[model samples]
Target: MRFTRRKSTLWRTFESRYYVMTLLTPLGLLGLIGILVLIIIYIIRPNFQQKVVSSTYVWKLSLKYRKKRLPTSKLRDLLLIICQILVLASCAFIIAKPACIVKSTETNSETVIIIDSSASMLMSSNGKTRFERAVEAAGTKAGEVLDGGGEVTVITAGPKAEYLCEKETKENKESVLREIKGLWNDNQNDIKCTYGSDDIDGAMTLCADTVADNPKANVFIYTDATYVNGSVPEGVNVIDVKGEEESNAAIINATVTQDQNNYVFSADVIRYGTENTPLSLKASFYGVNDKSGENGKLTFELKDIPVVANETYRITFRKDVEYTDEDKLRGYKLVEESKLVLCKLVADTDVTTDEEYGVYSFEQVMFDIAESDAFDFDNHYFIYGGKKEKLKVLYVTTPIDKNGKGEENPFVPAALSIAKNYFSSRLDIEVDTVMSDKQYLLTGYNMYIFEGLKPDSMPVDGVTFLINPPKGDYKEYGFDLGLEITSKGSEGDTLSSNSSNKLLDGLKAEDITVSKATSLKNFTGSDDSPYNYESLLELNGSTVAIARNCKENQTVVMSFSTHYSNIAYGHIAVLMTNIIDYYFPATVSGTKLEVGGKIEINARGASVIARESGFTQEEFTLTEFPATLVLTRPGQYVISQTTYFGQDLTDTIYVSIPQSESALTEERYSLENPFTERDDSDYFNDLLVYLAAALVALLFVEWWLHSRESM
Candidate 1:
């Protein structure tokens, strides 16, 4: 607003810095010639002839008129000459051009404005995202610096530090504004405004380097200060732009489980901020058929849901939707043809209010009934309603026991039956006993237990348990079953067992008593061998029970025979259940992945598709067996693929906002003298147009006076 002439050696020579020197030269020359011509014309008077008058009285009147005319005409001519000279001089000066420089005593400072672009910046209040507010704050700071003739550098801190506009001058401030306002474009792939985990260290490093290069430079960071925990660079000022606290409710955890032939959906919802008002939450369930078509829908509304700040509330919904024939057909196709039964759970705010200061939030979570099993808040869960497949166990025994009775050990079958019933609530288990010499097939059995006998050859693939096997019989199955037998009535008491092993579930060393047993020495392999079995139970430093898993086939060896031991009625039942559960785990545990993280899954040359609740679906094709998927947003994602067996497989994964971003608490920081003084004289404006207007007014005044004199 304020302008003054700057004092400089170059400016002193030019006199006016706003105009071209070449144009001023010709205009000055023309003005000088016009002034000389006017002076010559005034000095050289024209010759005139005298005229006779009628009488002496006429001569007197004519003399009086001539006197009046001479004074008036002389005044007019003087005024006209002065006006012409003024016009000529003004024209020459206007052509030379003039400029007014802004006056300031402050020194110019280079400034860098860093804006936080993390996912936390997406928090909205008053219909504006935190990032939008931060950008506006940054623009204000840039304007102040630019107005003072200081250069500005705008940097955005996202997954990495990026420069939006570098070293922008006051003349190009508009360009910087455009870049900041248009940070997010139509293309989501553009990383300029993509939401990601905050990388404050990376951004701070960039600021540190900038300050190191220019020791006196000013750096201003604009953010909500939610994720900033580490040290900041020296001379950097942080401007907190966070607004008032806004209440939000998030579905932190969701799970689906089957109970009594019905699917139960449960969710853990947490409220943030200080508002203790009750929020109405609506839960909707959408069932998709085999062709990915919606068939059945169920809606549940919970009004006046009491929610305490920072507290979690549990919400449950049972299967209330009546399925039609089409829905049943879709479920049947999902189980038989490998299609997927899709279930989507959406949560939203029931009441919409126009409160300016209050925040009404909603979140939707999706689940697939066919693909999910594990209970996790960060991933979608699937509930399988179909009957579980039974585990087939092949129990092989010798024709005759040492008792000389043809009947096998009753405790063996009793223990198997007890273990089978224990898991019957969740799993189906079937045990088939056969003689070792019988022509039995091991194709469909999931497990093989050998009692005092060995198979002709080891089962190609399955879990196998060897109980009291003869040393010579195990040699053919690549097992070094070296057993050292003592007297006939020899007994070995259990010394110690691995507590971490699931197989030793309820069995204690004192509870196990083997009346007739042999010591297993070097049973698995040599001491220096790398393929040794892990000992599950030990007696006096000798292995009583050891197990090993090789190429998906788990094998267990027990030195004592169950026929002579009381382990059958004791923890043996629990041990059998543990072994069955271990080999056939309910769910395959995968790597824990977070929001905006990457994970690799087996695709098997099938098309993999992933979709979040209320978002567009993304599809990927595997060139190889496994492909990597990048999670960009937080929600329940249903990932589906087809296997070579013509079975459709789908998985549900849940991703949640990071704890650091969800907390929504502001951090305070302090600094001393973070900004430097800026010089404001560089943006001087030209005054040539004002000078030209003044010259035109003078010409009009001169013409008006001349016309009045003639009248």
Candidate 2:
């Protein structure tokens, strides 16, 4: 009468057979589903009681079979049930196991990719930067996260932790992907750095804090493994781009110590991995003699070390090179086979005197760590053991600095006087009335001054003291023409005819000679301005100076001549001594730090690094050693030291401890066992899920029919 048949009769539930026959317990969800099915069927097809009667005796005869209606109805039901079973069975054969795949209502996640943009990542891996590989990997992870309803944040590392993107969405996938794909790998040249401190630790730590309120964030660190381990923050997941299966050979360390006679060529060659790699190690030195003759000389051969995975190879110069002024000032050189040499200069007092060596220093006299409690500790024994047991000083005539046209600049005097007057007691102060000749900072003092140089030619290392970078230095590149003075000569050198004096054409100083001063700064009469000659460090002029941390823990710098005024000179000794003292981080308790030890240095007050293994503090004078104590060894060591700020201000370092195995001197390591995986997919649930989808469709249809009837 309805002109239609029950489509339910033909509909099939593909996985019903297994659900009914399987010996496994029905899942709780399935039980609930069964209950729902019963309710739906009862509601959709409820039968009412019926009364049937014959109109007359004849009618009763015709309706004789009416008494069997109940049985007939029951029989009909049995047939329908049987037909349904057959249909479901047939469907089950076609689609064996069905599953009820449901959408998860859980929280979406966020991923932060911190790529290592440091120059070190420039090394080629399959012709691409390890940085590129890291970005690719991060992108992949980002895709997964996006697919899962999550977001991505990109952070980069170099001189600064570069935030390339913040919380990009799937909707912006094209732009985000393009941005990353277009990125070029940045190399770690150890040059082109804008800041003295490449605070990767601080960068990541900031990122972690940025996402602190976001519980869904996971930070991925993509790097070449340059950071000292302990410095890693706890909250973020580190995704080291240098894969666990990393095979790398590097010149990790090199040392060169010399004066005017000996030129030493020393190096530390290292190969590390889970597998062995062939390494051709050679050491060579290249320099120009006084005659300007090219001298490419000497080679130190290293015995091939057949090392196991995660091992190192070390080779030192058997014969130390003769000491030369250049060697101490220029630093050491590390040469890799088939690669250019990476060199670092050392300072060992090039300008020597009967009383003491020339010492120049710069001070961060106003620093934030002036309130640390670790100053009283005894962990400075390392400083006491070396040739640096006592402070050294150099004495010279007046007027520490000058400007072009032989005028006094306020900047130089202020910079030098600050370190000399305030930090005198703890330092081996040196005073040089005039600048010297020689390219090295070690030639005369533990520090050098750069107040007079062109601002644009700022050295890669060294503290720059000023409101502006020098004329030729990067700060003022186009404004004036200033030549980058090579480290070869001192401040008093005569200006070369070929040199451009336009940078200093209008420059003049009270006590300096014009010919001797070719560097200058211009000012527009701003009372509080640093470049303004008035009120500049009590000298009514501008000055320049530098302080840097270099080889074997030395911070060599230069102080421009304008800083040599009597207003500054009287305090030079104290400033110099204090700066030198500041170089030695004040001692904390526990004088001797043991190998594989935890030495906490609580730095209180202003401090800066001086020559090798030295640190000075206004309130405390002690030394702070580099991470791992010995660069040769590998281990987890923490310099739990901190400034008073309770910000983990101390350098927390975890050195990768050396294994005799690294030297391939002990025993070789072999893989003890193969890897295995455990599987956990629910084969039953998968089938059930598919079946549930069909059931859901059927349920919707039945509910619609019931609602129509109710209306």
Candidate No. with top TM-score: 1
Off by over 4 Å in 2: 1-109, 116-124, 144-150, 157-159, 185-213, 217-246, 274-279, 287-711
**lDDT (C-alpha) at residue 507 in model 2:** 23
How well does each candidate superpose onto the true structure, as a TM-score? 0.49, 0.30
Stretches of model 1 off by over 4 angstroms after superposition: 1-112, 123-129, 132-183, 192-219, 225-249, 255-265, 269-313, 318-441, 470-472, 480-484, 487-515, 518-546, 565-633, 636-651, 659-711
- The digit string of per-residue lDDT tens for model 2 on 501-576 reads 2222222333332212223333223555333221122112222322222222222222234332332443343434
Please estimate how well model 2 matches the true structure, expressed as its whole-model Cα lDDT.
0.39
Record all residue pairs in model 1 with backbone atoms less than 3 Å apart, i.e. clashing.
4-101, 338-648, 372-382, 378-654, 379-653, 379-654, 380-653, 380-654
lDDT of 1 by residue, 328-348 (tens): 453211111321122223222
Error of 1 at 695 (Å): 76
Error of 1 at 250 (Å): 3.8
